[model samples]
Target: MLDVLVIGGGPAGSTAATLLARKGFSVRLLERDKFPRFQIGESLLPYNNDLFDRLGVSDELKRGEYFPKYGAHFVTGDGRTEFTFRFDRILPPEHQRSFQVRRSEFDHLLLRNAAASGVDVREETPVTSVRLENESCFVRVASGEEIEARFVIDGSGHASLLGSRTGKKSDIASLKKIAVFAHYRGVEKPKGRDAGNTTIVVIRDGWFWLIPVTGELMSVGLVVDRDHFVNCGLSAEELLERSIAATPFVAERMKSAGRVTQVYSRKDFSYRVRDLVGKRFALIGDAAGFLDPIFSTGVYMAMKSADIAADAVEARLRKGSMRGLERYERDMTRALGRYFHFISNFYRREFLEVFLQPSNRFGLLHAIVRILAGNVFGAAGDRLKLALFFVLVRIQKRRPVIARPIRWEALPRAASL
Candidate 1:
């Protein structure tokens, strides 16, 4: 019997398996697909770099087509704004900038690192079923092979493998948005003032993400309202192109670009699993739930949750009890709660309008950005900062004098509305 059985070889699974194996646990990882696969969420925040270091896979990223990013740029209806809050800027001299990467190479590097650290890796192996018998978890492979383990981890991403089997999976209707995107080689990269910055172009119906990966290939995507797309009578690809063209900022950059790959659609991308854990089984990554990618926080959140799970599992193993899993569940809920609030807040233009007023000085806008980049949730100082910022904004808004058109360029510098 394996000490731990991890399903799905994505960032969360590999990280968990590697850490558990290093702690002397007999870990087995089952993956449905081979590595070098194409996946989205190309941008990386500084925290993800820390995760790579924890898994001892930092060097692999350095040798690839990676680009240093100091901050993000926003182009909204009002104007353009720039934010430069890289970890290197806030923390230490040794803390350099983060990198934008292609998931095909990035995910493969992570999973391979886990294998190198002695996790028994299984590729092209699909988990057929999971059964909790007695006190152990039995995982069956498609070939009728059975693997028994004291605990099982579901990192199956959106597949929600075990989660679907348990009938606890459900769609998050409020977040029913669809994404269509493609890679382009000749796409213009931000230069001079725009250099080293990722751009988020906000249009009427939705938003477009302009991520410049290495090798002159940029990842461009359109996230549109599901209802709008359904009513337009246009295919996802055509709708995406039309939306991108509608955004003057995005169109200015992508006008002459040629699509280097097929347009792909990620449908009904938001969801949540009612329960994140069972007797001897737990879910992580997209398996647990997924929110919109507006802030590009998906991978960071997944890896962070993995670290939390790894630590709890390690402690539980040492204590010879499964009680630590309770803490994991609690932490996961608290951690994702903040993001749920932030993303839900993002979809409402009326909520953002408060920030567009110059007299608004609650600093809620800035504080929320910082909190999103760091704590996510948990009652940390950043959370308090965000709260206070909101309080201040509400008080300031009570006065009619604090009303002014917030210019687009000033978006990054908005006080706290």
Candidate 2:
């Protein structure tokens, strides 16, 4: 019997399998799709650098053709409010830089690294069902194969294979959102060190993300409230075009660019599971929960949870008990909760006003920058920073300030190629 069975070949599964295999566990990882397949989440947070180093992929990532992202820039729809948060300002220099990658290449690299690390990785092997027994879990694949393992890990991302089977997944009502996106060529980019900075352009009903995936290619997407997007009576492509038109800075940047892929839409953007661990199994990555992509926390959360889950699994295997599972769940919940707390109020005008036109009162801007740099899961200092940030936000909310209203009418009309 395999010591561990990891479902899905994304960052979570690959990371878990790699770590466990490195520790001499008999691990098997199954993926429904072949490698080099297209995926959307291009921007990575700086914290991922540490995880990559632990996985021994930091040098490989550096050698890849991916764009180096140093920070993020935010601009409101009207282009009047804007601010930049360079990662170096708050995070240590070693953890201040990350990358914007083409998911196809990036994921493939990680999956391949798992195989190289002794993980028995099987591609195009869809897991049809998972059954937990008293002593082990049995996984059924489309090929009619049954694999028994001491423990099972669900890293199947949004598909939530085990999560759905056990009725654990629940949608986050407040975060009913849809994302429409595509890759583009020739999109205008900033010069110098800011060239790879991810640009977030906030509109009235949604926000746009512009990430540099490579020197000559960029990834552009809009995340909008589901109700507003559905009620717009526009196709996904149309909605994307309209969203681009609404964000002046994004419009100006893309004016001379052309899309290189078909527009894609993803719904039900936010959700959580009832629990991260259960009988002989645990969930990691999107299988456990997912948050809005405003801060580009998806991949970071996924890999971070995987790292924690691997530790728990190792402990369980050695002691024949799930001792560390509770800690894994607690740590992940606290990490995600910090993000949820801030993102829940991200769409509000007051938060945007404070964010885009930040005041350094109480060292609040630095606190906010630390969060943006994915430094929320660290020691006591990070917790204090987060608390200070929330206090500042509350103060900003109590003392409302009049800010410029977004001029929707001044936006350019939507156009096609």
Candidate 3:
């Protein structure tokens, strides 16, 4: 019997298994797909640097050829606005700097590190069923192999392996955008102070992301209205070309870009499961919930959630008490809720205006980034920061206007026409 059975090999499962293995626990990680596979969400937040170091794989992560992103740059219809938030500006000098890596390489590196940490990794063996029979969990793999474990972790990305089997999945209704992304070579990267910055370009309809991963390679994606794609009688490739062309700044940069991969698309990228934990099983990463990728917070949330789940499982196995499991749910919900609220508010124009306003915006962003750099967890501080930011936005909108007396006479309307 395995101490813990993790049903995915992505960031969450791998992190959980690796951490548990380091604690001298027997961990079995089953991944349906093999490593070195193509994946998306290539950007990494500086906050993840600490987690990497904790796993003792910081040297390996640093060895990958990656672009060092300092902060994010935004472009609205008016013009470009750059926010240069260096990790060193808020984090310790040793923990400063994050990388924009190619997901294929990054995920494989993490999985290999997990194996190196003494995890029993099963690749190309998909999970078919999970059952709680006779007070024990049994996992059935695609090869008709049955593996019993004291606890199970559902990290099967959107498959929601354990969550679905236990009827714990529910969709969040607010998010309704579709995403189309592709990798390109020879794409122009930002220069000088703006080098390695992720650019978010907002057009009339929706937004686009430009993330540079290497010297000449970049990942470009569009999050647009689903209906718009349906109305336009163009293939995904054509739509991407037209959309990029319409956005002058992005179009000019991709003039000589050659496609490195086919266009990949997914609709309704946001949803949350009703429950994160049930009995002996727990959900992680997209299996728990998935917000859009606009903020590049997916991978960070995944590994963080895994860390929380690993702690819970370790306590349960060692002391035969489920008390730590409850804390896991609370922490996961609190951590995810903070990001969910912040991302949900990004769609509102008034919120955007207040968020861009210098005084309140910069101060609040600094505080939150500091918390992330410090790896603050298991509390309401994250949520508190989000609430403060939103309150400032509301105050800006509700400020009463002062009436001023007009001294000039009114002109005739017909003369103007």
Candidate 4:
């Protein structure tokens, strides 16, 4: 039997497979899709830099020519308020910068790194069924090939292979939004260090994300309430265009731009699994949960979870107990909770007031910057930072606001999807 079987070749699966293989465990990773496939979530957080080093891919990534992102820029729909959160100013020097990458190239790089580290990687091998029996997992692939492993990792992303099979997947009602996105050329970009910074344009209905993946290409996406899009009756392309037109900052930047990819849409994207681990299996990455992309935490969280999960799996194999796995689940839950707390309140006026018009009083801005830098876990110092952030939120709620309320508005009659 193989020591481990990973049911995806994305960052999570590849990370876990690489780590386990490096530790001398036999790992086989099956990927449903081949590499170089189109994927979104191009923006990455600084914390990922550490993971890359741990996986020995830092130098490779540096040589890839991906856009170097040093910070993030936020602007309101009216274009009157804006601010840039420079990672260098708030994060530890070593964790001060990350990259915006084309997912195709980035994912392929990680997968290749895993193979180089002794992982048996099979592309275009979809897992058809997963059966857990005590301390062993039997996985059946689409080719009718059966594999038995000591443990299983469901890094199958939104497919949630094990989560769905066990009826553990559930939607997060509060985070009901759909994203429409595509790549474009000729979009206006900032110069100097800000050239790679991800720009967020918050409009009345939703928000737009402008991510620079390369010097000549950028990924532009709009996230809006699912109900609003359904009610608008627009096709994905039309909805994306309408959303772009709604944001002045985004519109001006894309006025002379032309799309280079087909517009795509994903709905019901926010969800969580009831459990992260079972008898001989665990879920990592999108299989565990997913939140709004407003903060660009997907890839970071996935790789982080994989890192933790790998440790837990090693411990479980050595000690022959579920304690380590349980601890991993708890740790992931707390880290994800921190992100969900901030993002769930993103559409609230009180949160926006504090986010758009930040105050340095009580070191709140520094604390927020730390969170934005993906320092959600570890150290008492981080806890203290988060505490200060919550206190500031409570204080902001008490202050009076003259701005308009944050409520969804109906699409204009001329709006087309």
Candidate 5:
């Protein structure tokens, strides 16, 4: 019998397995795919610097070939007005920047790091089923072998190992959306120092994310409501092209760019699993829940939750109770709720009106920067400031407190890069 069995080999699984093994627990991690696999979510938050430092991979990242992202650039869909939320505004100089990584290499590095930490890592081994029976879990692999473990941690990204087996998911009605994306070569980027900043263009129906993953490559994606796509009657690739052509801001950057990979689409991307903890099981990462990537919170939240899960699993195995697991559920719930609320309001014009115009009168911009940097668990005073900011957005909706942003003309005129 194993002390703990972790499903999937993404950041959540690798981080949890590594942490548990360091505690002297017999841990095994199963990943369905091989290393260096292509994955999305290339934009990372500055908060990740803290996690990597603790995970013992900070030095490796410095030695690796990755781009440092100092801040996020927000642009109007028409490319008229914009703002850049510099991470240094809130974080210290040493921790003010994160990175834009090719998920393929970054995830592989983390998985290998886990193996170095004494974790029994297995790649290309997919899990078939996970059964929770009393104080232990029975995990069956695709090869017909069954292993019993004292506890199970589900980090299977969107596959949701335990979630699918237990029917613990609910659709996010207001956020029924789809994402169409691919890699490109020679996309226009900002000048030096600003080149690494992730550019986000907010459109009428959705938004566009342009991430400089490497010196020669950029990951561009279009996110919009599902109905909007269906009504257009275009394939994934066509949808991406039409979206780019419609948005002059994005079209301008891609003028010199060429597609390097086939387009891929993901739909119904928003959902929540309330029952994240069980008697002897727990869900981490995307297996727990997923909102949106507006604030680039996916990877940070995954690893952070895995870090928290490792401690809760350790306590559960030692104390012989579910209290630790329950606490994990509550903490993750609160954290996810904060992001959800912000994302839910992000699509509204009122939110953009207020967000485009930053203010520090009552430390509201300070509060916004905290959340943008993935620090959702700030003090009560921060929460008050965030609430006041939201109230200001609501007020702006009823009464125009500022000038309305400029819109694009029928034929977008090319803008300087």
Candidate 6:
């Protein structure tokens, strides 16, 4: 039997395969799609630098050409309220900045790096089902080939191959979100440090993301409530145009830009897979759970889960026991819970009121900066910092700190007109 079999060669699976092979475990990775395939989630978190270092792709990234994302700007579509959080302003993490990448390029680089580290990678091989019959683990592929391994990892991105087979995946009812996006060129973006900045253009019911995927191509997308989208009775392209036209912030930037790719609509699943850890299998990345993408936590959380799963898988290989598994679950749950809490409040006017108006009281704004920099999974001090920030949000609700709570008075009138 093989030591480990990783499903899906995305960030999570490839990361686990690379780390495990480096630890002397025989690893084989299967990817449903071939390399250089199109994928989304182009924006990355600041702390992904360390993960890149661990995967030994730091040199390739530093030397290679890619957009260096310094920080992110959250702005109202009208430009009345805005806040920018820079990674350099934070401490603790040595490398605080991240990169805006075309998913096709970044993912291909990671998978190829895994192969260089001795991971047996097979592309265009989709896992049909995973059967854990007693102690023997086997994965059935699309070609009717059965691959046997001592342990199996469900890193399948959106397919959730294992989660669907075992009926472990369930939807989160609260999050009914749809993302409509496409690529464009000739758009005039900010210069200097702001050149690589991702702008979150906040609208009344939804928001738009502006990311520079390359020196020339900009990835622009709108994320809105499902009801609001369906009620419009328009296609994804129409919705995107309507939204951009209504939002002055994105309208100004995209004025001279022209669409260069087909508009794609992604329904946010927000699905959770139960029993992430089992005797012979584990779900690492998107297969484990799907988080809201408002904070661009998908890549960071996926790689982090893979890093943790590698330790657990290594322990299981050495001790022949399911050790370190519980810790993986605990740490990921804690981190995801914190993010979910923060994301849940993001759509509310009360939370946005305080969050947009940055405050540095008692280092609280720095705490917000820390979370924005992807420091959610840290010491107890991290929790305390986030808690204090939420306290300020509540306090700001009752008594306005920087200004009165935004009534969006002019927005409704403009919409009606």
Location of the lowest summed lDDT over 10 successive residues in candidate 4: 405-414
lDDT of 3 at 365: 71
Per-residue lDDT tens digits for candidate 4, residues 1-417, read: 999999999889999999999989999999999897887899999988999999988887778879899999987766666789889777787778899999999999999999999999999999999989986989999999999999999999999999998899999998899998999999998889999999988776678899999998989988888988888888989988876776667888999999999998999999988789976999999999999999999999999999999989998877787888999899888888888988987876567756777767767677777788788766347677667666666676776452333332422212444
Of 3 and 5, which scores higher on TM-score? 5
Local distance difference test, each candidate: 0.73, 0.86, 0.75, 0.86, 0.86, 0.84
lDDT accuracy of residue 124 in candidate 6: 95
Cα RMSD for candidates in order: 4.6, 2.3, 6.3, 2.4, 2.9, 1.9
lDDT of 6 by residue, 1-417 (tens): 788999999999999999999999889999988899998999888777888987888888766667888888998888788888888666554656788889998999999999999999999998888889766699889999999998999899877887888788887778888889999997788889888988988788878899998889999998887777777778888888777888777888889999999999999658778778888888888888887788998999999999999999889878976759878888887888888898889987778888888778777777787787787788467677678778778877778774467756544211211
Candidate no. 6 TM-score: 0.96
Q: Where does model 2 exceed 4 Å of error?
A: 401-417
- Kindly give the stretch of ten consecutive residues in candidate 6 with the minimal lDDT sum: 408-417
Q: Which regions of candidate 4 fall more than 4 Å away from where they truly are?
A: 401-417
**Number of the candidate with higher lDDT, 5 or 6:** 5
How well does candidate 4 score on lDDT at residue 84?
Answer: 91
TM-score of each: 0.89, 0.95, 0.90, 0.95, 0.96, 0.96
State model 3's lDDT: 0.75
Off by over 4 Å in 1: 77-96, 192-194, 354-366, 377-379, 392-403, 406-417
Per-residue lDDT of model 3, residues 143-256, tens digit only: 899999988989998878777766777766777777888889987876764678787766656778889988778888888777677776777777776777766667778889
